[model samples]
Target: MPKSPETLLEQEFGLIAELVHAHARARPRHPALIDECSRVDFGELDQRMDRVATSLQRDLVDVGDAIAICAAASVNYGVVFLGALRAGVAVAPLSPSSTAESLATMLADCRAKFLFLDEHVAKTMATVALPSGLQLVRLDHSPGVRSLEAWLAPAGSVPVPVTIEPDAAFNIIYSSGTTGTPKGIVQPHSMRWAHVRRARNFGYDNEAVTLCSTPLYSNTTLVSFFPAIAGGGTVVLMPKFEAGKFLELSQRYRVTHAMLVPVQYQRLMDREDFDRCDLSSYRMKFCTSAPFSAALKADILRRWPGGLIEYYGMTEGGGTCMLLAHQFPDKLHTVGQPVTGHDIRLIDEQGRPVPVGSIGEVVGRSAAMMKGYFNQPDKTAEAEWYDAEGKRFIRTGDVGRFDADGFLTLMDRRKDMIISGGFNIYPSDLEAVLFQHPAVRDGAVVGVPSREWGETPIAFVVLRPGATASADDIKQWTNSRLGKTQRLSAVELTTELPRNSIGKVLKRELRDRYAQASS
Candidate 1:
């Protein structure tokens, strides 16, 4: 019999792939992964993983070498990721939505020996100059290409086992950089183990079913993905997010757990048939990645069926704060308290710790932090902060203050803070007021160059459908509710705001557009 989940996790460090294989031994017939096309049970899933590992070994891919995957989420993708882990290879999951250049840069940055992709991603990457000696394996069947099915070793193949240490590189998740090549964040096995162990508190077990709406490249998706398998649960992967499809699958699979960003929640709530969907099976719903508004939290609490949790932290693994929205309705504005064993503090511009209630840059230290930025020691050093006691913490680049009750209220990203007439302004504060306008469907605030104040705030408004609100009318109304320093210089009407795949408003894009228009 396989070891129990709790016993395996009780070790100093554990391998995710080993834990998954253990589950296969314990419950071979149980469903382990579900994608749009097929369902894979634990028994078959384990065999597939072994075949992938054995094939990599045959290719002479050594332990700790990296491989890259650039495809939509699918059963084969999951197997490749797990199999690489079993062979002690770190998987670099690249985003398909990234520009071809950016995608190529990431593949090169990780020093991958193989690039696993689907026909769709292959067409997009046709223009990319692939690194020399990098093998291409198609996840889907393509007549002329090397396919994953053909690449796999014979049935019953078993790879030579290897040890995975606490500090061994597990995966390299790249930052969402729009400009040059994004830096790869190297997360270790110990860090992922910490996430899996902490996930036990959220009720992941053999019976748990997790629905993942985000792409596999994102850490947002993996946080829930790894935990489900480690706990012997079933994971349902979506090719792309459609609110209606998500609701349908949630009810179809009786999904018990989910990790979603805030905008996804907004879309789900806005669906005309939302109230009709049977979401009563959800045990817990998680939100992260961007600022989750208090209003949205309350809306979900009033209408949604399960406990809602909002996590506040960075992908680099710093201090984390979690707000159990169901338990603290009155404290909806704050992002709850720092999680257990995470030391989160605020520091001024000069790196001094701020006073108890003062707003400063958020810095945190935790057992789950990343190893460092891959191949970029200087960039890694720039993201670190050492306390007076010489302990290291990752800088979160956010400005926030702690309330008397220890809850954190985020102000803004330190880089996003606008200086108007020598006074500081948080765009979130202005955006909150903009959201209050009845005719506003979506909005954002950005600072533009101004000769008078050095910089002045401008508003971008997406008016509600069929609403006859002019930019001037919205600006007048917004300014009427604001102080002199916070008033907008202009309000430009737009159909929608540009956002990244995970729903963070692309403020840099908005700022650049405004600058070019003014010029």
Candidate 2:
């Protein structure tokens, strides 16, 4: 690491707790968090996190034990996460938007003895079946749940200190298994440390103030959130996202940085008064976790002021690719080359290396790879690929071809591809044709089971505001432009598509609902 004299954070990368302590002492009054419910400065955040660590030890919680938290984004949410790190305990963050049964299953997967809940989560989960002898406490008051305040240690209480190593478990983030039960992806301290180190290139520092609207549990959000705090910068959190409000905060806080998904950019750009905001302070912005259209990238580059960079990687921490859209406008259609220290390559269905620039699945190896899926060694192994010399790589499940320039142009997810008349069809190709129409605002194509073709392409689209072009009109217009095998059998008009918490379109939900409705 390069030497810097800015703050202790530059030198305090061994454990996360030490960095928090350094920030608290160096700049006590620095605003560390701005959340929907409350704002906390560096000193108060450190003290509260210390209380949590001490409280856990007082309750006989041992180091390396897991603490489970299912809650909305808040200052308290940040407290629990930082505190667990302080006490050398791993935290399991469950998805709040998951079904009750699914949530219960994940809780069992992590095997946490104690579960923490936000007040709102307590009301809904109060009826869900949980393991016997597992204690549940709410962050704040709830009608029928125990409050966390009663369990917290005194303000001056100190936690027992322990040495932390690189390989110790940091947190378990569950995968969004669109097909079945989710698997817990175990990230270690070393992996997290690598993330912190990688962040330096993005310019996260004491002067930086990051705006994070997405949920804290999602790794999509954390890739940006953790870096700011680790660098002793303030993090502004939003409980929910609204375009007008997002711009308003950007103007009010002179927000220096943000990590938003592609959909949020679409909504912001779609606003009529988007250009009116005073956003000159923004130094950098990031997008990931969903398909970012080339057109949208061009539009944002034409309008938004900040440096826009898109990241392409899995939450499992395989090799990562970065597209600096601002610098490579000609390469807007492609996600940029692999990040440093990451070896990315293409492989065929049989795991054989494809020729350079050929379309194949993306597999990569990196220093930041996950420890493994918690307690699922076989499932963990299933996601890895071993090269000829036996170096391991993680499968990205997406098909793409690399250009001579080393930029990767994605075709479609392996599971999302359609086979019609024994020919492969990429939905993105069909969607690109659909987006060419002036009336088309946002579009997605899914392969639906068909009697004649085995599986056929079906398009769902949201039209531009005030546009009245019919679905049949779009279907005909798009089909005329696409190749025969990739043509959409039908186009459905909708106000909006189903999406998850992080703004990823829920195509599976659409397939299930529409397929049933048609049947």
Candidate 3:
């Protein structure tokens, strides 16, 4: 018989290096990564990573030192990431497209010592003044920067030895905070392996050809990548997600699995180019970050005719719940039941468990949860807790409910709820109704300040190409579906909604922009 969730986690937790080494030995000849530039096998990947490890040691990089990686998705980035972890150094992978201000803030927050940047990003970084105690190295080319190629040059000898513990920090992923400054969610080596185990159970297998359309720096990519590697599968990397190119690559590479946000799906489905490419190669499709409307979900199922999976999670907690296509017929809006080893509960504001079907905060305990925020003990303590049963659970800060069948239906973020004319409305509920319109491609409902109501919802919409619809038309469409108080008072049309690295709509940024324009 298989071990229980507690026993399985207890035994496997914190052994990332060992796991990777084992995979290297087992599947050395297997294709590990395929990018636009080249494809690398496990044997080559292992050898390159070892060389990177030796280089870091030669540079006198101490254990636990922060190594920031600022590059696009490539084989070099993957090798450097694994090498840093193997050398017992904390890795922070920042988006290559990030602004100077954002990059500087993350560098200072993590106290990163050495940076590995792409040639283009290096040129940009050279113009900015770096913080004290920092040194920059180019992954491709730059002056005074150690090139990744030169650093990994043929060296038959290994350097100083390093030891890594399960609980030790592995990586710091910066969260896209809706309110405050972005916090670095510190994940340990063991938690990463746990993520791999969970991902394997979630459906990544040896035969899977996982498509890497999302930014590798995001948690969605990290969770998917490690498992694909563990299962001896190949990862097809896309520099960035472009709807037409995405479909072409999927068919060309025969990609069997993929992860995407709802907005991407909406955009792809609306494009005329979607019909020009073949997508029958995709077998597994997963989405996260935000809820998808029933109409959108139905459209995807009709288009792909493949498995569709929905996962509800945050940067802090890897994945709390998952709903698969098999379960969609009945639990259409549900985020699915808890995976093995996760204990879930919906609680009221007073910290008491709410009755079934009551809207409340969703909290859970799992092996995939992050260790804590880096160097922020108070924030960590506030977010983490041990239940009366001694199971560790992290507060999700999302308002949701469990149905009689024990499936979870997320209502909205507690902070995202809108109040208008002394009435409360959930943006997701309103957005779901708006998505039913044939003209709407993608939409985000945000609370804008109002003179009468404390805050009213204003819809920002992206219409389907060649499908024209006015703001008033959409407003009337929503008003018919929602209550008088829940109706949107205004609508704005845009080509695209502003999104962060992970494809999450930055509602706060939208609100700020609207406020400025109105003032």
Candidate 4:
């Protein structure tokens, strides 16, 4: 890791502000951002960010202050984020729909001095007494709270010299905790740029127009956005993901690239309106967050021809494994290979390297790996290791196996594995079987505590439009495809399965609910 002061202004600038400024100078008149209501050129974006930074400095929010961004995915939110980064503040983007209790907990945990709340959420926040020393800054529109727009009006655009450290905390993205309170993952500016460099090397170029259909607060979105900006690409922002609108927007903007979840891809393919749109503009499409079934992968390839790419990574380290479009023929199920500059290993509980075709925990050493969990040294220490050979690695908490060709195949999450009748069953295997049913639109598998088997597999399924399937029928379908140990003991038909903002199944919630009911 290079020292922050010396590395801050390099080609791969460590500071987020430097990334934005580099693009602004290179492409001043280029369209940098486009939301539903507004568009900003690189020049305007740079100037606005300067003004926002000036306002924060004038308000006495000095360098190293933590700022919480709680706004919808809008143009203003992006501006505020860049400004805060430029002012040398650690920016934490809070989910707009997070509960007041969760918000309060996160705010206090991060020790944020300024809270930027969207108008709708601002009103709800006002009813609750905020912790002392925290200032509420309203975004978009709200009464009583200081508006971001109002604050920027008097602050003139004068570029301030910001001293930045590459290793300084840049952002704190809170993970959805399954066992306890959500922990904030502390990512440094240099780590972010490392991913950006990797992304650029993977063919994201300056002329690319990247679409932002995923939530801006998502890890995938951050990975794509920073790289797009650093490479002087335009960002087409969507406030939320809507299957119909997403297809249309891609054509409207001639979007060159996009990142999507498997569910979104399924929904888009099922929509009759999707085929009518001109989707030829998309050149590259990356899928992450969840595994796309082989059939779904084939469908996507058939639909988009050569545009699909599959990547496997976690928030702790970005782009650990990627299966490029070219490698899909030989390794369709593989998460490609370890990305460049990353060392991947599959190790057993004994800390020895597992043989090929054997499942073990996936560990990686990458330049883009996170520094550690925010304020959680114990957890960090538990997650990382230094081998006798002097190599450092971060355990992924995911179970995977490598093929003879060195391709990685994901088995299951270590925490989500089901033990039924003393046999281990991965939920993904059951979920894949359930998705094979034509009537099943979405499915999630969870292990419910059972006195007889120790743990029993249960499934929650959502049906397709106008398709009604009973739980027994779905269970029968799953049983036909899976072995006895992997088959679901019970199935529940629901309108929808609960998912986090990033579209990951909230299996922990399902497990708890079903475990309680069975007890």
Query: What local distance difference test score does each model get?
Result: 0.87, 0.81, 0.75, 0.76
lDDT of 3 by residue, 1-519 (tens): 433322333465644444555556766787888888888887777777777778777777888888899878887778788878778889988766555655777888898978888876776577567889787767654567877776674755454568887778889987631112447899877778777777765556657799888777777788777777766678888877788888888888788888887767877888887776777777778887655666778778877846898877767873378788655666767888887677788878888788887988888877777888887888888786565677677888788888888889887676676645323456876787788889999999999876444477999999999987899998998777554446788899989999999999999888998999899
State the number of backbone clashes in model 2. 0
Q: For model 1, what is the error of residue 269's alpha carbon versus the real structure, in angstroms, after optimal superposition? A: 0.3
The segments of candidate 2 whose C-alpha lies over 4 angstroms from its true place after superposition are 1-13, 177-179, 417-519
Please write out the lDDT profile of model 4 over residues 1-519, one tens digit for every residue.
323322343465566577677667767898888899998988888888998888878778877778888877878888888888888888888766555655777787788988888777786565566777998877676677888777784545775678988788788887641112557888888888787766765557778899887766677788888777766788988887888888888888888888877767777888887667788877788887665667767777777734677878777773388887554665787788998778888889887887778999998887777788888889888888666797778887788988887889888777686654334456766676688899999989888765455567889989999997788998997786564346689998888888899998898888777767767
Considering TM-score, which of the candidate structures 2 and 4 is the better prediction for this target?
A: 2
Q: Which stretches of candidate 4 lie over 4 Å from their true place?
A: 1-13, 153-155, 177-180, 417-519
Clash count of each predicted structure: 0, 0, 1, 1
lDDT of 1 at 69: 94
Q: Which pairs clash (backbone N, Cα, C closer than 3 Å) in model 2?
A: none
Which scores higher on TM-score, 3 or 4? 4
Q: Rank the candidates by TM-score, best first.
A: 1, 2, 4, 3
Off by over 4 Å in 1: 416-519
Question: RMSD for each model, in Å, please?
Answer: 10.6, 11.0, 11.2, 10.6
TM-score, candidate number 1: 0.82
Report the Cα lDDT for candidate 4: 0.76
Rank list by lDDT: 1, 2, 4, 3
Winner on TM-score (1 vs 3): 1
In angstroms, give how far residue 37 of model 1 lies from its true place: 0.5
Better of 1 and 4 by lDDT: 1
Q: What would the TM-scores of all predictions be?
A: 0.82, 0.80, 0.76, 0.78
Q: Could you give candidate 2's per-residue lDDT for residues 202-279 as a string of tens digits?
A: 879889989988778788778887888888899998877788999998888889889887767877888999998888
The true-versus-predicted C-alpha distance at residue 304 of model 4, in Å, is 1.3
Candidate 4 TM-score over all chains jointly:
0.78
